[model samples]
Target: MQIVVKDLAFGRINMSIEKDIQQQTFRNSYQKATVNIIFSANWLTEQIKIFLDEEHITPQQYNILRILRGSMKPLSTLQIRERMLDKMSDTSRIVDRLVLKELVEKKLSTADK
Candidate 1:
């Protein structure tokens, strides 16, 4: 009757797909795998959000920063979006926010213009 979620901060590492979702059984391995992937993704996103929250940035913004840092060169917003973990993210808006926060700088691309 108790709901349990994996919380690394409290030293709780054990997690089971069946127990986590309160589903005693799955229809098949494919279904189980799908559900597990979704559940794990959501859990991971939550964890990332917690960390990002501490840094006062959204996941999208964090994704952009990571991409830019790894690229070691300027990338257009389109390029940033293409490399984003969440394709649905509004890359321009996130980049703008980052610019306002002074975490990232935006420059006009002469090549594009």
Candidate 2:
């Protein structure tokens, strides 16, 4: 079943997940909610990609920039990777690219030196 409701705050009509995905049935509410969450996340990612594309940066690079911007001090590649949304990304390689772009700089810590 599809439910359409007026969104008072946004002054828009909101459609049910069923209508959005064009699927009318699920195993249960939990399954429906899971699908909704995944679908919403993907939609949001696409929206973000559109904006990020103009800046000539990938989502992973943007993630690193945000991480660095918010940190009180410089962080290592491992630290940045731990805080990244996509942990599986190659943080070192992204950082190297950022260095090439002059978006971020790399420094050797006293301990590493």
Candidate 3:
């Protein structure tokens, strides 16, 4: 993996990517872009993981919190899944964990009836 380092207004920032996964360079622009997007996602995930670890929360739980906070209102499990980065995630299970931690509150939505 190549850790690209760059200097910005804040200071030097580093992003890690898996370069060893493929020995040859990308065959085309699309291929390169695909790898770049995955790399960026993973890098972002790592940053989020480090921050959430201190709060004793998993990345999935942290993601749910962000979605709920962004809505500024309560959301149903289906609604949360629709808004999440990983739509395939088990919103109900993840919410249960967050609710256990007091990081989230869940109530039966009016629409659920």
- CA lDDT of every candidate: 0.83, 0.82, 0.71
Clashing pairs in 1: none
Runs in model 2 with CA error above 4 Å?
A: 1-14
User: Per-residue CA lDDT of candidate 2, range 3-103, in tens?
Assistant: 12232232343458898889999999999999999988887777677767766789999889988988888999889999999989999999999898889
Candidate 1, residue 92: how far the Cα is off, in Å: 2.4
Candidate with better TM-score, 2 vs 3:
2
> Model 3 reaches what TM-score against the true structure?
0.61
Q: For residues 1-113, could you state the per-residue lDDT of candidate 1 as single tens digits? A: 11123344534755789888999998999999999999988888788788778778887887788888888679999999899999999999999999898888898999997
Model 2 TM-score on a 0 to 1 scale: 0.74
Candidate 2 displacement at residue 64 in angstroms? 0.9
- CA deviation > 4 Å runs, candidate 3: 1-43
Clashing pairs in 2: none
